[model samples]
Target: MTAIDQSAVETLFTNARTHNVWKDKSVSEQTLRELYHLMHFGPTSMNCQPLRVLFLNSQAAKERLKPALMPGNQEKTMKAPVVAVLGYDTEFHEHLPRMFAHNKDAKSLFEGKTDFINTTAFRNSSIQGGYFILAARSLGLDTGPMSGFNNAAVDEEFFPDGKVKSNFLCSLGYGDHSSLFPRQARFEFDEVCRIL
Candidate 1:
């Protein structure tokens, strides 16, 4: 019978910021695995965990990514220790029997509903991506989530088979505050929310 402390939770939410620059340090593969293990618990629509991630760490892979990025984002992405391609599987509904609870034949729900399936896939994958950022931050790594890359090119380069599509990219590493701009402002809770 103990009251939940709000301040501690708030610190995790508020203190995390999008870091554009990173230190020379590298993030271990074990840490990335731990982050995934923690983030996997976040809920997804129909329990269909459609989010697929490709971690780019080597210089060659990062170089392959440079041409797909916006001019503003290239350097930040290239310098980070790890760059994650957050993507969604186009045929994720095919595995619904295993992913969706109580729905033994869940694939039938999307049999003739391609649009619905795609919408659900993207929606849930985006939620999972948010969870990933929080999980990385909780593990003491900073994140710079950006949508400044060319999706078509990224798809061509990484997911050439076309079964999955890139949603966004996140750079992870020890943050270099030297390049960070001042913290941006946010709307007040009253302005952004409504009490029903």
Candidate 2:
């Protein structure tokens, strides 16, 4: 009904930055759970909530992910209190029977349609990933979302069964502003949008 205040807008959008460096503080498991609770409410087509997240917070897990990272992403990823491997489950439609109870045929709709299933899984999981970043920001955490890694390697390391695929990696924590580059310009609304 009503718009959120300017400070809330700033917290979630206008002033949010892609963090590279992080403060020494740690992100508690409770906070991480809360972040998921907040983002899970974001909508998806047919209620096909396909996104799966793996939070790499320990030294051993970070080590496992190191070889898959691009050189630029390694340091920041290792240093951040949490590195989230946001993935999409190819078998997401299997859950539709439970998630979309009113529509009994929802699961069957995607059962044998590989192309359609892939498209929906990727699209909706990506949308949820955006929600994840905003949810983290709303909770006073900063995020550095990067896609500069070997997807296959990440999948082999984290999702060995091949049912889930990595979409992107996001490093999260209290950001160190000193490491931020100057904000870049964005296209004006009129230039990027159409009202016809």
Candidate 3:
């Protein structure tokens, strides 16, 4: 098969930025569901799909999240159309046997090993979080991925369960062009990449 067009792929990668502001227009729940459906197809280690997304769009939910955010991020997160809480379930491996489609007793591996389970869960779920950013972009949405938050506070307010922990937060919306700064520069391929 012929390789995908380099320039076009480069455009998508280069042009995507962390949008901080958005117009007043709303994002439909259906659109969010579609995004999840598409991104779930992305691969994960051992088919252990641990990422759990919590979309906070309601006034009450956003209010609850306010205290957890850094002061700098609170305004943007609250103003954005939707704030996605990317989290991972420590119990993800419990369903791995079914997810793997035939690997019986997969749950046994993580049954009592809390440390190992947390490691795998966070690693794979972080991959899913990256998938979410690309998936949202593909659906004509702009994203602002942020980690400037109190994860422990967020988990207490939103997740509540110790098994599910927050990874990062991202604002999603139809971006406001008026709020964007000039695109920043990137290192040259030769400067950043080395061939053996």
Q: In candidate 3, what are the lDDT values of residues 142-172, reduced to their tens digit?
A: 8999999999999999888687999999899
Q: Best candidate per TM-score, number? A: 2
Quote the positional error of residue 117 for candidate 3 in Å: 1.0
lDDT for every model?
Answer: 0.90, 0.95, 0.89
Q: Is candidate 1 or candidate 2 better by lDDT?
A: 2
**lDDT (Cα) of model 1:** 0.90
* Number of the top lDDT candidate: 2
Residues 1-196 of candidate 1: C-alpha lDDT, one tens digit per residue: 7863776465358666789888999999999999999999999878889999999989899999999999988987999999999999989988888778588778888877879988988999999999999899888899999999999999999999998999999999999877788888889999889999
What number of clashing residue pairs does each candidate have, in the order they appear? 0, 0, 0
Clashing pairs in 1: none
**Tens digit of lDDT per residue, candidate 2, span 13-64?**
9999999989999999999999999999999999999999999999899999
What TM-score, computed on C-alpha atoms, does each candidate reach? Answer: 0.94, 0.98, 0.91
TM-score of 2: 0.98
